[model samples]
Target: MVKTLSRANYPDLPFYPERMIQFGEGNFMRAFVEWQLQQMNKQGLFKGSTVLIKPRNQGMGPRLDQQDYLYTVLINGIMQQQLVNDREIITSVSRLINPYTQYDDFLRLAENDELEFITSNTTEAGIAYDPDDRLDNGPQKSFPGKLTALLYRRFELGKKGFTIIPCELIDRNGEKLKEIVCCFAHEWNLGESFLKWLDEDNIFCCSLVDRIVPGYPHDKATELEQELGYEDKYMVMAEPFLLWVIEGPEWLKERLPLAKAGLNVRVTQDMTPYRERKVHLLNGPHTAMVPLGLLAGLETVEEVMTDPSFSRFVNLLIENELIPMLDLASEELRSYASAVQERFNNPSIRHELTSIFLNSISKFKTRLLPVMQRYHQEKGQWPELMTLSFAALLLSYRGDRLQRQDSPEVLAIFDEAWSDQGTVAQSILSNSNLWGEDLTQLPGLVESLEANLRQLEVVGSRAALEHRIGVM
Candidate 1:
C-alpha cells in the first residue's frame, strides 16, 4: 500500500503564516510561484505561506486540499547545456478556497493583517471586464469582480492594501487589471473614497512569467510514486529554466526578497527591455522556425537545430535577420541567441513543430512581422528567410500537409485567397486585418514572397533551403 502525502503522515513538516493570497490553484502556481516561495522560506529570506483561491468554479483546489497542499515539483530539462533532474516537495501553499463555494471565507481572508501580497495567473483572458458581475452576488463570476468585492471588504475594516503582481501574459497586465477593477467600482457606485483607496493603496505590478509546467506526469506517476515512497496525485513536471520579470519599484524587491533566495527573478522599474528581449529573441525565432521547419519536413524543434541546413537557417535568421533589426545591445542579443539555440536543442524537450505552427498568421504578425518591417526600414530590404517563412506560412494554410489549427474565420479567408493562386500572394499580404497593416505597401515584399513561393513550389522546402544556404 502507498502512503498518502499529508501533515499527519509526514509529521515533520514546517508551517508558516498565510501572508499571500494567490489566485489560480493550477500547476503554474504550484510549480513556479509556490516553488519560489518555498525556496525563499528555506533560505530564511521570507517566512510566509500562500492561501490559494480558485479563479473559476472548477479547479484542483479540492484535490490539493486532499493532499494537505503537499505536492512534488519535478524539474527535468537543460540548464547551461547540462542535464538537470530534480524534485522537491513544495509546502508553501497553506490551504485553498473556491470563491463560488466559500464566498464568505474568501472575502474574510482580506481582513487578515498578515496578508501583504496577492499573485495571480488567471491567464490572459481571465483579466477581462465582465460588466454583468455584481458585488452583492454570492460570488462574482469574474476574477476582477471577486477581487473588487474583497478589496472593499478590506477597506471597510481600514486595512492595508495588497501589492498585486499579476502573471497574466498580456501587455501591461497590472494596468489592465486595475482599469477593470476601477470600472467595476464605478459601476457599483463604490464612491470616490474607494476609488482613491484603490489607486493609492494598491500596487499593481505587471509581470512576465516564462516556464513550461507540464502538470501531472501520468505516464511516469507509478514509477515516481514508487521512488518517493508516497502517493502524490498533484505531482507537476516543469522545465529547469525559469524567469519572472516583475515591473515595480526597487522597494518591492526588498518586500518580496526573491533575490535573497537566489532565484532568477528581476524586480525592475521598467520591464520594457526585458520584455522586448523575450519577444524578439525567444518568441520571434520560435515562430519563424515553425512554418519553415514544417515545410522542410521537420517533426520537432530539436530536429530543426540538429539538421545542418535548418541549423544554419536559424543562425542566419537570428544573427543576421532578427538581431540586427533590434535596438538592444548586440552582445546581449548574441548571448541570448546562443542560449536560445541550446534550449531549442534540449534533448529532454520534444517540442512538436505542428503545435507551434498553430495560429501561425497571428504569431507571425506579432513576432516576425515587426522584425521584417524594422529590417526594411533600416537596411532597405526585407529579410530573406523570414520572407520565405511567411511564404511557407501561406502555403501551410492551404489545407495541405500541416493540421490547420487556427480560427475558422482565418481558415475561411485563406481558403478564399488560395482559390486564385495567380494573385494569392497579393491578396493575403494586402489584408490589413490579419497583419494590422498593409504589408503589400512594404517595398519588394510581394515580389520576394512571390519568388520564394515559386521556389518552394518548383524545387521544394529542402532544396530551397540548400539553395538559400549556397547563396548566403
Candidate 2:
C-alpha cells in the first residue's frame, strides 16, 4: 500500500481561522508570506488562516489543490559556522479560490467580516490599468481592477476595512496600488460612500521582502525525492535568512507582532533604510557583477567569488561605488554586504546570471544610476567600480558570441547599435534614456566609461576589470 502524507502525521501543526485573502499563489508568496504565517500560527501570535486567490489563469493552483493545500519549504544556508538544513510543511493556506472559475465564491469572500488582511505579490505587470474593466465584469482583467471591485463590494456590505500589504518590487508599491484602485473606483463612478471607506478605513502598507526562492528544481527531482523520503510535487527551496519590513502604523505591530513570534520580520514607520540597504548591497552588486563576472568565464555567483580577481572586483564595487553613496553606518553596511556575499556563495543554490541580465538596460537605470549621480555631484569624482561596471553592462548588451545566446530582442538592439558603429562608446554613453540622463555631461563618467568599454572590447571582461582595479 502507498502511504499518504496527511496532517495527522504532523500533529504539532495548528489549524487557525481563515482571515487573510492573498492575491497571488506563486513560489515567492508560498515560500515567504505563508511560511511567516505558519510561524505566527505556531507561536499563537495570530490564530488566522489564509484564503489564496489565483490572480491570473496560469499558476500552481491545480497542483496546490491536488496536494490538499499542503507543501514543503526547504531552507538552506550558513548559520554560526554550520550549514543549516531544515524543512517544514506549510499548512496555513486554508482555501484556494480561483475567481475565473468560481465567480460567486470569489465575490462572497468580500462579505466575510472575519477578513482583516489582504496581501499580494501579483508581479509588477499584474498591477496595470485596463479601460474596459468594469464593475459588472465577472472577473476583472487587471489586478487593480479586480481589487477595486472587491473593495467596492466590501464597502457596500458596510465598510469592513482590512490592512492591505503589497509585496511588488515597485517603490511606494502600497500607496501606488491604493491610488490606482481609487482611480478605478472613481472611473467606474462607485459613489462617495465607497470612496470614503477606501480613504479612511483601510491601511495600505508598503513592504520590503528579501529571500531567494528558486522554485521547483525539476532537473534534480530524483535526488530531492530521495532526500525528502516522500513525494512533494510543489516543493520550494529558499535561503535560511528572511526579512519582511512593513511601512505602516503602530497598530500593525500590536496586531501581528511577528517579531514576538520569533520570525525575522519588522513593523516600522520608515522602511527607507532597509530598502536602501537591500537595493544597494544585494541587488546593486548582483547586477554589477553579472556582465563582468559572466564574461570572465564564470557561470554562477559561487564561481565569481572563488576567483580572486572577480571577487575583489565585486567587493570594490560595493565598498567604493555603492557604499559611499549611502548614509548608513559603514560597519552595519559591511555586515549586511558580507551576508549578501555569503548568500551568493551558497553551493546548493544555482542563481543564473542570464536570468538576472533580463531587462538589463532598465535595471541599470533604476538600481545603479542614482548612486552614480550622487557620487559625482557630491564627491567631485567618478566611482571607478561603478563606471567600469556601466561599461561592462554596455558591452554585455552589445552581444557576446562565445559565452552564450541572447534573446532576439536583445540581439536586435545590439545589432542596430552595431550597424551604425559610429563611435560605439560615445553613441551608447549618449543615450539619455538608458543612463537616465546625458552621462556625456557628467564630469569624468563618459570618458572613463568609454575608455573601459574600449578595454573590454580589446582584452575582454576579466582582464579589463583586473587592469582597471589594479591601477586603482
Candidate 3:
C-alpha cells in the first residue's frame, strides 16, 4: 500500500515555526530554496518553516496544502561522472497562502514575530510597478504593490522589517524590488511614519540563483511514483549542481547557517561577480542560443550543446571572446563556463529553447548587451559571435520565425524596426531606449550586425554559424 506523505502518517517528522516568508512557490523555489531549507533543518542548523505567498493567482498554493504541504524534489545530474538520481520529500513549506483569495490572512502574516527573512523568485516579469494598483484594494495586482501593503501592515504592528532577498534574474533584484516598493509608498501616499519605518527597518539584499529546475518530471512520472512508493503532485526535477549567491552582510550567515548546513550558498557584501558570471556565461549564452538555435533547427538546450557546430560556436564566444572582458580570473571563469556546458548537456533534463526565449529582448539587454559593450571597450572591436546573436534577435523580429514574449513597448519598437524602415538594423541599434545606449554608435557593431543579419537571412542560422566558424 502507498502511504500518504504527511506528519499524520509518520508522526516522527519534525515541524517548526514559520520564520521565513517566500513568494512565488514555483519549481525553482521548490527545488532550490525550499529544498536547501530542508537540508538546513536536517543538519539542526535551522528549525524554521516557510509561509509561501504566490506572486499571482495562477499558482498551486491550494493544491500544495491538499497534501499537507508535502512534495518531492528529484535532483538529477551527473556527479563525478556518475548518474545521480535522488528524490527527497520537502516539508519546509508549512502552508501556501494565496494573497488574492485570502488577503486578510496574507496581511495578518506580516505581524508574525518570528518572520525575519523574505525571499522571492517571481521570475523576470513578476517584479514591476503597476500604476493602477491602489493601496485600499482587496489585493494589489503587482508583487511590489502587494509587498508594500504587507510591509505597511508590519510597520503598523511595530514589527521589525524583513531582510528582502529577491532571486529574480534581474541585476540588483533586491535593490530594484525596494525601489518599486518605495515607488508604491510614494504613489499610494501611504504615510510619513511608514516611510521612516521602511528606511530604518528593512534590509534589501541582491542575489543570483543558478539552478536548472526542469520542473515536473511529467515524462517519468510513472517510473518515479513506482520508485518512491507514493504519488506526489508537486514533484520538481533539477540538476545536482546548484548555487545561490546572496549579497548581504556578515549577520546573514549567522541567521541562515546555510554555509554550516553544507549548501552552496554564499553571503557576501557584493554578489556582482557571481551575478556577472551567471548572467554573462550561463544566461547570456542561453539568450544568444535560443533565437539562433531555433533558427539553426535545434529544439532543446541539450541539442545545441551536442551539436558540434552550435556548441563550438557558443564555447568560443564565451571562452575566447567574452571571458577576457570580465574582471574575474580566467581559471574561475573557465570552471563556471565548463560547468554551464555540462549542465546544458545533461541527458535527463530537456530544456526547451522556446521556454528560454520568453522576454528575450529584455533578457538580451541585461545578459548579453553589457558583455558586448565591455568587449568593445577592451578589445576596441566588435565581438563578432555576440554580434551574430544580436543580428539573430533583430532578424527574428523581422519575421515570424521565432515567437517573442517581450513587453508591449519593446514589441512595438521591434515591429516598427522590422516594418517600413529601410536600414532596420542600424535604426534599431540607434534606439538607446531599447539597448540602454546607442548600439549603432559603438565602433563596428552596427556594420557587423548588418553583415551577419544579411548572411543569416540568406543561408539560415545553422549554415551561417558553421560558415562563421570556418571563416574564423
> Best-fitting candidate, measured by lDDT?
1
Task: Give the alpha carbon lDDT tens digit for every residue of 19-68 in model 3.
Answer: 99998888999898899999999988889989999788885745677678
Q: Rank the candidates by lDDT, best first.
A: 1, 3, 2
RMSD from true fold, candidate 1: 1.4
Error of 1 at 38 (Å): 1.3
Candidate 3 regions exceeding 4 Å error are 100-104, 130-141, 183-193, 400-424, 431-433, 457-460, 470-472
Better of 1 and 3 by TM-score: 1
Minimal lDDT window, size 10, model 2: 1-10
lDDT of 2 by residue, 162-256 (tens): 89999988888899999899899899998888888998999999999999898877887667777766677888888887889999998898787
Better of 1 and 2 by TM-score: 1
Write the residue-wise lDDT of candidate 1 on 383-442 in tens digits: 888888888889889888778899998998899999975678899988888888888888
Candidate 3 residue pairs in backbone clash: none
Error of 2 at 350 (Å): 0.6
Count of backbone collisions within predicted model 2: 0
Q: Which stretches of candidate 1 lie over 4 Å from their true place?
A: none
Query: What RMSD does each model have against the real structure?
Result: 1.4, 2.3, 3.1
Model 1 residue 361 lDDT? 91
TM-score of the candidate numbered 1? 0.97
**lDDT per model vs. reference:** 0.88, 0.82, 0.86
